[model samples]
Target: DGVGLMTAADVSAYAHADDGGVEAFVTAGVDVRGWAARPGEGAAGVQDPGTINVVVAVPAALTDAALVNAVATATEAKVQALVEGGYDCSGTPTDAVCVVADAPGPHREAHAFAGPRSLWGARLARAVHRAVLQAVVIADRDGPAVRGQA
Candidate 1:
C-alpha cells in the first residue's frame, strides 16, 4: 500500500497559480493499494483488494452540495488513474471520500459554485490525480509481489 498527502499549500506551489486558489484552498490526500488478479483476468474477474480514499479541506466559500460534488470528482479521477495504470478495480476496490470546509478566512467570500466542471473541482481533480499517481509509483517500487510476480 502507498499513501500520499498533498496540502493546499503544496498545490499552490505545484500549480504556480498566483494564489494557488489559496483563498479557497483545498487540500487532497489519496491512499492507493493494489492487489494481484489471476492472469488474463479482466476487471470483473479479479478479486480486487485495492482501495482508494480522498480527504479534503476546503474554504468556507464552498457549499455542502459543492463538497459532495468535489468528492465525486475526486473519486472519478482516482478511478480513471487506476484504470489508466491497468488495474482491474471492478470487483475488489473501495473508494471513500470526504470534504470539510475551513474556518472563515479573511476573504470570507463564497464561490459562485463547485463541481467537476468548475474550476475548483478541476483543481481538486488535478491534486487527487497527482497523489494517486505517487501512491501507485510507491507501490510498484516496494512490492513486486503485490502486482504479481516479476
Candidate 2:
C-alpha cells in the first residue's frame, strides 16, 4: 500500500491596534506515493514522488506579501524536516506544495509586521515540521522495505 503523512498547527500574532492582531491557522500534509530504499537512487521498489500541501486561514487584515512569505516559510520548513530526517532530495524535490489562505475580512487591518523572520514564521515552520515528522514516524514503523525512502 502507498504511504501518507499529515499534520497541522494553529497560531496567532498580536499587532498594534492600528494594524490589528492576526490569527493564522495552518494545516499541512505530505503524501508519498512511493519511495526508494536509498536517496538519489532509482525508484526501484519505491512509490512515486511525494507531494506537500497546506491550508492557511487568516483574517482579512493580512497582506498579500505577508501571505506569500508565510507560504515560502512553510515550504522551506517542510523540506528542512525531510532533509533532517535523512532524505536527500538534491534540491530538486518532486513534491507538490500548495498553500491556500482565506480572503481578507473588512474588520481587520492588514499588517506585514515581519516577513519570514517573525514569530509567525517560526510557529508555522514548527507546525509543518511536526506534521512531516509524524508521517515519517509512521512510515518507519510500518516496515524496513519503506524505511528512510523519501
Candidate 3:
C-alpha cells in the first residue's frame, strides 16, 4: 500500500501547480516531508496490489460529510498521481481509491482523518482493522495457504 497527501512535494512538482519549476517551488516553499505514495513494508495501510496512504489539510468543522468529502478529494488526487506515475486504472480514477469498508471485492485498507486527528491513530486503526479482517478471511479461506506479507 501507499501514503497519500494533498500537498505532496513530488506530486506538486509533477503537477507543476506552481508558477516556477518543480525544484524551485519545492525548495523554496514546499514541506520537505510532504509526500504521497503507497505504503512500504513497515508502514500502515491497506494491504493490496497497490494501495496508497495519504493526508489532506481539512477544515476544523469535522463533519461526517466533510470527512467523507475530504476522503473523496484525497482519493482522487492520489489516484491521479498514481496514473501520472503510470498506474493503469483504466479511465475510472475512483477505482484506485475507495472507502475501506467497500473494498470493491479487492483486499484493501485505509485510514480516515478529521482535520486534527493524529496520523498515528488513523494509521493504527487502518492497520489493525484491515489486518485482522484479512487474517480472519485467510483463516477461513479454503484450498489456499494463508500467509502474511509485510
Candidate lDDT scores, in order, read 0.49, 0.45, 0.29
Error of 3 at 36 (Å): 19
Q: How accurate is candidate 3 locally (lDDT)?
A: 0.29
lDDT of 1 by residue, 1-150 (tens): 233543222343221111234222222222333333436645465433444445555544676667677777767766666666555442123445565555445777556455666877777666666665555545454432334121
> In candidate 3, where is summed lDDT lowest over 10 consecutive residues?
22-31
- Stretches off by above 4 angstroms in model 1 are 1-50, 90-92, 103-107, 142-150
TM-score of 1: 0.55
Top candidate when judged by lDDT against the true structure: 1
Q: Can you write out model 3's per-residue Cα lDDT over 4-94, one digit (the tens) per residue?
A: 3342122322211211110100101111112243245234554232223233222132345445754554444443432343333311211
Ordered by lDDT, highest first, the candidates read 1, 2, 3
Candidate 1: pairs in clash: none
TM-score of each: 0.55, 0.53, 0.28
Which candidate achieves the best TM-score against the true structure? Answer: 1
